[model samples]
Target: MNTIWLGFSQKLLKVDRYIKKSFTYQAIEKTFAIILPFIIIGSLSMALSSSVFSKQGFFNQIYDISSWLPYEDVIKKVLEIINTVTMNFIAIMTAFLSAKYITRSFKKDEQIAGFTGAIGMLILNYNLASFTSDSNQETFLMQDLGIRGIFISLILGVFVGYIFKWFSPRNKQEKVDQYTFISRGVGGLLPLAIVLGILIGLTLLASMINQMGVNGLFYSLFRLTEIKSKHLIITILFLAFFNSILSGVGISGPLGIMQGGLDDTSIVSNLSYSLKHGTSFGVPFPISIHTIYDSFGSFGGTGMTMSLIIAILVASKNKNSRKIAKFSIIPSLVNINFPLMFGLPIILNPILMIPFIISPLVSMIIGYFFIYFKWMPPAVYNLPRTTPAPLMAFLGTNGHWSALFVSGIVLVVTVLIYIPFVKLNNQAALIDGGDLNEK
Candidate 1:
């Protein structure tokens, strides 16, 4: 068994290396790495603002104590606004980061490229009619400004980055005073002008396409808002697999697509059924990716790395691994695992890849069965996506202890599954001369 496992690990490492060398993959990885702090901040704001623990969150819970606590309302409002601005604008921010990394890869001015990409993103979603003489033809929708826009934003980022790279003065060694900021600013003129021109042209082309009764590229790409039931489980499994694989390469797949395009038809349908029946006692929610998978399958963020964090804390003797676990604990509680994911540098590590991909799938199945068997009530409340696990189950199921209990069980299972994998990783690190103790 050891020999067989060794052979598989060698092959997996080779594939991992090949993937790391891909320019596209590297761009995506670096984009996520750059934007990770935003994701964490946004998630933290959402979690704090959510009334998961109460009927009306922090404000309502503290309503009666208003006289004692000054500025409760002010604090609450600040958190909500923070959530709106940061979490709500993730798509546009991602566009900026993607372009920044892609342009940097081409050895061009990344800041200029990033600014251009941000402008392009805003223009693509901007309502021309609202700003122009056609006031009666307002076409901008609020949904398009958020998660739905991520896919197109990423594509546009790459497009704008490439255009900037193409127009940048290449292979020219001009002697200029390094101390002069104006010299650098002037150097960006050609690429900036060209990128802006193309952006304007694309906007006109999109408008023309809209006039022909076609939804245009922006609408077509962002309109995948539904994931119907025919192959729902299969879709969940595939998403779980793909998201893990992408995260293994340091790309956030859920932030890119799954979280954006996933439909909640099952959750909605089940809630409607429960309402009409007047009792949710025996009826269970259908196998729902949003309710079960989102709440439990991704217990510790993208690759469900929380379990791995636990394993590292409990079983690993390596001080570096323990330190990672220490730093990751608080973030893990909030369902943010990027620190561990990137710091442990799970990206492209062959040994950790296997269980990283499999753990979520296993957890999804476990959660589905628990709900299907009526071991817990269906998750009716649309809890915040950033709501931490087990508690997410509790709030989502409307104060069901059973749901929380089931979530606890799934978390334990996840931890157990990750133990051996963590052990293997630790052993390999030790063999490779990894520092086992703190200096």
Candidate 2:
């Protein structure tokens, strides 16, 4: 009775902390990690497809069959080179920015301690991909955040460091200090502040520039989008997934090419094609849910759009996580998609295990139910995913409008499903008292 009573006591004491730690933050972060890669790719693909068709430019002949055979295969190679280069550049930016944000934001400790702790966790987070990948199960790094090597590194680094600080030797004396802001790592705090300022400032500068000129930004956007290699859904899911693993060791695409022998496998592409042409939406096969996006002519992606919403909604609810939340999402919305992914580490976390599986299943089930009930039309349309995905899906359905409504329904359902799990996990975390990262 006493032991049982103690267990109940612990549960009661930590319930609020659980809610604080989990919920919106985890879901959104997972959303960020997986979907951002596709957003970049899809946006790039749409840009290319649009340019090729409009101007008869480099990518204009994408539909031409001769290009992939002997003489024209070079076009494919060039496109491959461009994609690799772009992905690499992106990986670097995400790494540095993500690393700094996670470490600094969650630290809430002395400047160097939080920063160093964040850095320390970084290495472990990157390792999580290999740490979690399995043949039967989807990769542990999570599909929403493709090219996860960087995001995980950033996330784990921050998490571990903050945890470390929480366990800092100053426990007894420090707890007595009333105002935390005045505590600082006090002296080291200034440098930490400067580092954070610099990172934020640089990101803002980039955003302002991108937002300033619409046409130029659009053109740049087109060029980037046009740089895709083909069978986009697959590319986003598999190749992007593959890229995450390689990124951990700093071995990006060309770097892999330099290694000699190669193996080709693209599960996401095969799945994407099956989702579009192979399987009918009503079929019980799981991929039909993708048709949810397909209901619109322009909706080529389902994973990222929903992922972003999940991340945003989850992060907003968790007050402690907002520091990381606020900055990550804006840039994420634009094309550089890391803010949400690593900021929260939603993918492999045990707390989210239920929702990750449940949300997708529920979304597909509800989507199917709506279609069957005649409350919503079948998602038979096809279109590229660009700009904002969910909203685009709404327009592509020829204003089926119901798809948008359905998407909203799915988002709300996902949140409802994910909340309790997040709460349980967050409470576990607080009681366990954070990662080895500084508090």
Candidate 3:
């Protein structure tokens, strides 16, 4: 048994090393981790103003100064603007960050990389000709600039980085004082011009394809927002499982790539139909896997690792585990678990992989059944993905306390599920001569 375990550990470490070395994983992982603070702030802002909490939560009662203010509406608008600036431009920011990371990896110019990312995103999402022709300022849809565009932005960022790197002067023998600003400008100009021309050509091609009665590739990718039927439910379960597996191997899961296009419209439509017919919404909610996996299954980002943090804090016998728990507690509270996910180094660890992937699946199943049986109302409101679990359930269900209660129950259950795994992980660390006093 010990030999078997040893061999398994060795293989796990190998896979983990490969994943860490992959450039795509490193770029996406760093980009997501960097943007998490913004996600947390934006989520909190939305939660405070959401119908579920705007006039009812303890925050409203304690901070009722808005009621006394004559300019309460103005204050509300300012809050909305804050949320808009932070969360509404998430894709643009992610593009910049991803390109920046890739540029640094290639030892190229990071500032230009960020600029290219932002510029590419703009070209991909908007047509400059149409914008210049339109006199109306409200022509652009904000959703296209936010989470809806993340996948496109990510692709564009990486492409820009690679294109720039290729265009960078390579031969040291032909070096014309490349360190000078003049030499750098001369080298970079062609790449910038070439990329811009390619963007225009691609846009024209997409337009031509749309006019030719073909479903344009860009539109198909951007418009896949609703999932229906039992088949899609099974497909999403597999997608979630696959993403978790990737995450466990130290690769950033492709949630935004594989499932980002899906939205909460199906659940909203079901709720609307139920209201119109004066009947309770049922079974369909069981298949609303988009919101379920996001709000419940991803209790603490990718492998439901937040519960593991809780377990480490409350039940661990190892000092290193508790130290990691303390450091990760704040970020986990806001639904950012990168520190715990990588630091406790759940990424490469075999002992935790089973529960890491399965726990979220189990949570999804439970949340679905709970909603299906009317134990909790179906989530209708489209809350931010960064919304923490219990509040996520509440806001999503539009003030359904039962949903909040179920979220709490799920948290406890997740922690309980993580206990044995945490214990085993601690034992493995001890046996492998790993540090127990890590800060």
Evaluate residue 76 in candidate 1 and report its C-alpha lDDT on the 0 to 100 scale. Answer: 65
Residue 103 local lDDT, model 2: 36
Question: What local lDDT does model 2 show for residue 11?
Answer: 62
lDDT agreement of model 1 with the native: 0.66
User: Would you list the rank order by TM-score, best first?
Assistant: 1, 3, 2
TM-score of each: 0.67, 0.38, 0.62
lDDT of 3: 0.66
Comparison by TM-score, 2 against 3, better one: 3
Q: Give the TM-score of candidate 3.
A: 0.62
Deviation from native of the Cα of residue 398 in model 3, angstroms: 12
- What tens-digit string does per-residue lDDT give for candidate 1 at 1-439? 9899788766765665566566655665666555556555655555555533323543335353445656766766787787677656666786787788787777777777888888777767666556566557655534555544555667777887788678776634433334257656775788778777776677767777663111135344423544444766767777677668867754454434545535446666767776787545554545656765777778777767888888888788878778767767656665667566655657666778888988888888887777667776666666544456657777776688888887888778888888877877776665555431211
How do the residues 31-120 of candidate 3 rate in per-residue lDDT, one tens digit apiece? 766665665566545544542234443344445644764765565666677778877888789789888778656767666777778776
The CA lDDT at 376 in model 3 is: 77
